[model samples]
Target chain A: MPLPGPLQDLVAEFQRLPGIGHKSAQRLGLHLMAQPVEAIERLASVLVSARRALSRCSVCHDLADGAICRICADPARDGGLLAVVSGTREVLALERTREFKGRYHVLGGLLSPLDGIGPEQLNIRTLLERLRDPALREVLLALEPTVEGEATTLYLSRLLVPMGLTCTRLASGLSAGAELDIVDEVTLARAFEGRRPIA
Target chain B: MLGGNAQGKTNLLEAVATLATAQPPFARKDAEVVRFGAKDAIIRSSLRRGGYPLRADLCFRTQGRRAAQIDGVPCRRMVDWLGKVTVVLFSRADLDLIQGSPQGRRQMLDRIIRQMAPLFHDEEARWSRLLVQRNALIRHILTGAATASQLEAWDEPFAVAAAAVSRRRAALVRSLAPRAERWLEVLSGGCEALGIGYKPGIPGGDESMSIEGPEFVASVLEALGKSRAQDLARGHATVGPHRDDWLARLDGRDAAGFASTGQRRSIVLALKLAERDLLREAVGEPPLLLLDDVLAELDPSRQEALLEAIGDGVQTFVTSTHLSDLHGAWRARADICQVAPGHIARPSVT
Candidate 1:
């Protein structure tokens, strides 16, 4: 027998989510239906409130619950160094490492003309304004090494580097924890070319 | 090389070709090409290219994409290894360039472009992916699942890929046409004239359909906009370079429409020779030529012309079943090999 109207709609909603296929969607919908009414009510409230509380940080465009994200408000970060990322996800990822002691500027996306993403569509205007902070001496392009990412980085560098700012990028080679045997030839070739001396 | 039907003559050429082809048609070791019971197949070659000895390896798995290693180093991206070993092939299937569907001609043209541009494969691959995505997005729009404004998300990328692919193809045909004309003249002793023209599928506001830069991409986007109704009805893309083709004109007339059998053979050979010349000029090194049963189709005089033109400039591999077809000077200079179903023997040091 087919699912009832509401349950079928629930399954369809689940299916629309990324990575959840038809089978998973059906299972999840049935499980949700089995939950207590109060528990389901609380879950829905949490989802809505969490979404409502969060906002894009005015400074960096990272996820924030207020006008400024914790990173932008933090006084301890190295103001001289600013890392420009294509998305706020990178900001969270880098923060988890606690290695980069600098503030960040999120473009929200990259410039991919074919994909209908252009300079105007991204958080690029804020990125340019952030560069005017005299304390910031260097901008690190923390973009993926993909064609669109490269194009965006190149576009930014051409626009910003001439303004007397030192620009840098993440080194591309074999990823950390990746074995030498499994490293790809292009990366291997680059690794060999960019090999550093052990002092 | 001498081999009967279904022998390993073409296999040797395919093995060499595997190292060069960006997308090996049989890379997924499934039917006829990979032996009936084999899980995987690998082809390895070491040869002098650009006067430097290079080692290339191609690995084909039953269920995954093919992998390659150059000098024993695994390629993370095949683009690094593609075009490193180029080959110009002439097989019985090549007759389709004049007689078969447009798809065959496009495949042959794309292979040449892939080798010449080096990045053409990546661009074309991207185009193919965007085509699928854009088609789905179009479907979504037609069904009210997505807004028309969201179409730009896929159209922009699709246009980029379409422009790049068609531009390279146009450039290749532009350069190839004159060279093929000259080669055809040489083969026919100035009796035949050839004209190759690339027909870009995009509208460019003129009779001439040449794919240029930004304007070409804008044209594609516009064409996509115009074709939205038709595309919606079909539930797929109906515009772009994916539908590009080239036409051959013999003596200022459509060759495919009314060319003699002998004249058609000469056209194919002229096209093949022109490809070899174009590749050599582009790469600064002659590519390996694989001729499989093509000699039998050409007349005796044309055969001599081909051999004389080749003159050992590039490494050439020829496979023939009839020994009588190959004569004195050519037979004397070539290293002969006997090919059977499962084995090959170096018979003589001719």
Candidate 2:
């Protein structure tokens, strides 16, 4: 027998996710159906409330409940240093490390010409606006090591250089705990390039 | 059971090569390898190396896709499974390395380098993707859909990836040149001195020096910047590792221009032998050698030199229409198998 319309719709939505095939989507849809009605109700409520609560922060374009994100709202964070990233996920990733005490500017996404994404499509205007602070000293690009990430970094650095702002990118090299023998030659070469001298 | 032309001798050898590399050595596309009236073709082999058993299965669909498995586990990516069963295929087409365009020689270098450094496959994939994306962006810039500033985004990464490829190619040539010289001297009875020179696409590259890491990346970026005007006009990347080539010089002269057919054959043989030696040293096991009806093309002396180079460690599979085509030593040491239409049989030694 054919699944009910809502169950079929749920299966289709599950299939839209990466790595979820028809069988897995169908199984997930069936599993959700077998659950108590209150469980589904709870899931729907949580999804709606999360959507309602979270909006992009006006300053950094990061997820926030208010107009400004917590990092931008915090008085202790250094406005002199701004870390630019591709998306909200990278903001969370950098936050997890607890490494930086500076503010952040999310570009929303990298500049991908083939995808019809350009400088105008990104949050670059706001980033430039944030950089208007005379106290802002350095702009750190925390982008991926992929081609798109590097390209975006290059583009931004070129733009920032004329503005007399210091621009830098996250160091790319072998990951911590990665064996030297297994690391790719490019990463190994980069590690050597970025090697720091000890006293 | 030996037959004439259009038989399955070369086909069987190609199947073995396919199993080893998950790619047919001769076919340009996967669909070309599939037989007429067949939707797909499967090549499976049970191999043993260093007392360890391995199985490789490759299926080529007519729809131009392939599926590969190693040891009964599906490979998520072809690059992950490639080089697991290393192979060195010697065919008549290898003559193209000398007589054909620079692409063939570059492919030879890339194949050997990929086997020695499996990570090279990943680097190569990234390089190709970057090249495509950069080219597309260039087109967009030409069409006024994008601005000149946008090119900067791709330039750095393209330079980095290009440097990675060119550095490895340069290193491979540096290592293989001497080995090739030694092999050629042996094969030519000390009559020829072969030199393999790496000519990176970067303008003003120092042929004698080895540059890696940041220095190489800087040179590539500079080259890209210099070529930006021309590339913008052409709507594609005209500079980088994709345009790199390795020159084969005999007695310090360009082998492509002056070497005879016989010398070219010997040079190719020497290069393959050098590849085998390097793979042995790198992987700790000699790679399988697939000689596809090449014995008939070589003279007896060259054939003898090839056999001497094979030595005892490497496992070799040679295919020929006639058993008499091979040297007596080959017949004596080889397990003779007769390949006929649609069938193969192992005949007892006479």
Candidate 3:
């Protein structure tokens, strides 16, 4: 027998996720159906509220609940040291380390020419606007270590140089606890080239 | 089971192997596999795995463009779709793994590693691209078209990617060495001991050091820096895992330089068996085995040993010029297929 209309719709929605296949989507839909009526209702309400409450920050373009994000509003954070990233997820990842007490400018997405994502498509203009402040001395590229990320970094670095701001990239090398024999060559080379002398 | 020489026997086996890995074992570029005067070629197969029927399609065009599809859905990334089907192929050229250039041995290691860890393909592809680009930058620097600082920008990523390739290659050799040794002993009737050692291309790397560890990347980076002047003179990047090799030893002697022809063949056979065993352990089921005119290369006793190694419950495809070249038992127990120009006779069930 065919699935009911609403259940079929739920399966179709689940299938739209990145890794979910048709079988898995069907299983997820059935699993959702088995949940208590109040639990389902609560999930739907939370989903709507989360989507409705979040908006892109006006200055940095990071996910914000208001016109400006908390980091941009915070005076304690270093406004001069701006870490440019691809998304809010990267901002959160950098935050977990607590290494940088600087503000972030999320590009919303990386520049992928093949995918039609160009400089104009991203939040690059807003980034340039934020950088116009003479107080912003350095721009740190906190992008993923990928070809696309590298291209975006290069493009942004060239743009930043004309503005007289120092451009830097996240140091890519061997991870902590990674062994010498198991480390990939690219990371190894990066670590070697990026090595600092011990005082 | 029976076909004349150069009658698509090897090509058929190559096609099956390509289906599983999305790469042609013998061709460095996909264009090399396409027929002369033909613009493109397609290899498609319907496979049944774990009670599920799946279809794989690979399209190869000139100038190195290719596409892959699984179950009628195009795969955006080759890494995401690889390893859905596992295979082990034994060809006459496998003899080169022991007697030929280090490049061939490296390719052998890569094939096995790709099956063991599908993600290794992505790492290898990234490393390959970085190496090519870095070498091109070196050439540009040599010609005064680019600056030294431009080379500096590429060094870090090159080292990182190289370290990954070296590490994976080292780990694969470590895992495969003992298994190959065991198989060699069985194949040689416990008369010979085989040793397999990973010889990294980095200057300080040895059998004792872990090739995939953090220090390996550091050392490789240092080596690349040291070789920059030399590389600039030569107009290419010279040092890294692309030049790395694995040493096959027979009773502690370098097999490539000292082992007899029969010994080399034995080593190749043992490595294939070890590969099959490792794949079985990795996927929890035996992989399909493709033997392309390789059984005829082995003597009767070695052939019997090969048959014994295959055991039971494994799907195997063996191509040869004659049924007489195969074991008598294989002739009786296995279904027979005949191949001719542009034709393949269906397997006749006994």
Candidate 4:
């Protein structure tokens, strides 16, 4: 069956979406046709508005309509404590904890050598630049504790420790409330190594 | 076109995705998805929700079986079966779930919403339709046939739809926060504070996720007015939830960058368990947990912990290349089945 001119183009476009198929494209086309003119008009308006409005923050690459993201904009954040993360979303995750009263540096990604994500591809330079701020105290390497994260952290620590910044890492071990025997060896080792002084 | 070694895994996954999303998975005319030297292929999958089962059967010639059924009854169109069954897949590629490209995370977030709220899939489709029109309008303007002044005409709808997507994701994440945190605690053993945050393309400027309904629409409109010129030169629009992502920070650090391999797996597992919890809370029941080759990746202890977390209630389908890896604990709870080249059998497990 031949679809009408505009409808055929619409179907083609619909098929380009994350998971829509040709049949779905037709259903959507028919659904669009069934809608009130205002609905169509309203949808069209929203699509344009969303595209035009959002921007990435200059400092963090986080979605921002302003010059800086809310986290970057907030004055209360401890400028001294920098939690290095991979992307804007992780920045949001830290913010939700309300536990970390520190500023963050979004790395944009981890160091994946196989996929060609190296130190240069990530925001390592920017992180180094962030250290220039005199108020900076600790550069908490907040990346995932993967080999890449470890490589990045080790790489950063080599640079950061010499710079005299208090380089700390998030503790790793068997999770609380989980069985000890089921914990992986590496985690078990980390648990023993990072064991704190008995209060 | 799919010829790489890793590509086969991706292709198989895509085929399943194509089936799940395409309403009548078998009705499509094109069936060249199989690899070379394979005489034929048969894809049989069932979509079930709320105990309602709809089956999709696709047979190929160069590719063999093509048929579909809803409730065991024959069906003609794929659309009839879509949105009836939903699956959420988080692969190793999801390492970027926190740290990689915004586009990757955006798709992940949308997938969560797409599963929970089917209408979101439709609304997103509608939004995409408008995006194409706006892009076409821009293309026309670039060619001097249309004026840039007309850009505002499209920005209005763009903002509204984008705002709707942002609000839905925000609300969904917000609603799921407690569960996410709880699951994180159980998975991580409460050592680190678990946090989940939503970075909206356009911030509502309020902390409690206040952006909802027309207010979000209004704010989005205001934003579109702000970024109009940048959109024209780029040949595409920037900003919005399409560009936003969820960030996970574990104990004041980036979960992706700071998390170890085992930690990343733990976090991802936590996320999966969180989704299970979220579904159970949002709806009254849990979706079947399909553990595909995940046990091999986990150590014996983590494996036991994982099984413990899943419990016995939720229906789970686990697959492994070897049975020894899954020995003890879960073996009894799971119905054992075996699969080999062109064969499947139920082997007794003592």
**Top DockQ: which candidate number?**
2
lDDT score for residue A112 of model 2: 75
Q: How well does each candidate reproduce the native contacts, as fnat?
A: 0.00, 0.67, 0.00, 0.00
Candidate 2 per-residue lDDT over residues B1-350, each given as its tens digit: 24467778788778876665566777888889888999999888898877989988898899856888888998777765766777788887896688788788887887777777766877888898889888888888888888887777788888888988888999999998899899999998898888888888877764764566587788788889999999999988988888898888999898999999999999999998988888888888888898987888888888888998898977888877777788888777887776768888887443
Candidate 3 on B246-297: residue-level lDDT in tens?
8989998989899999999999999999999999998888999999898889
Interface RMSD of 3: 7.6
Docking class of 1: incorrect
Using lDDT as the measure, which candidate wins?
Answer: 2
Candidate 1 residue-wise lDDT at A116: 54
RMSD, each candidate, Å?
9.6, 3.9, 11.9, 23.0
Question: Which model is ahead, 2 or 3, in terms of DockQ?
Answer: 2
Off by over 4 Å in 4: A1-199, B1-68, B72-83, B86-90, B203-209, B348-350
Q: Every prediction's TM-score for the first chain? A: 0.91, 0.90, 0.90, 0.73
Candidate 1, residues B118-180, lDDT tens digits: the string is: 667677766776676667666666766666665555666677778888888888888888888
As a whole number from 0 to 100, the lDDT of residue B137 in candidate 4 is: 63
TM-score of each: 0.69, 0.85, 0.70, 0.54
Report the lDDT tens digits of candidate 3 across residue range A31-112. Answer: 9999999999999999999999999888888889999999989999997799999998899999999989999999989755
Off by over 4 Å in 3: A1-134, A142-144, A148-199, B63-65, B347-350
DockQ values of all predictions: 0.06, 0.43, 0.04, 0.01
Question: Residue A150, candidate 1: how far off, in angstroms?
Answer: 11
* Candidate 1 per-residue lDDT over residues A69-111, each given as its tens digit: 9989999999999999977778878889989999998888876
Candidate 3's docking class is: incorrect
Pick the winner on DockQ between candidates 2 and 4: 2
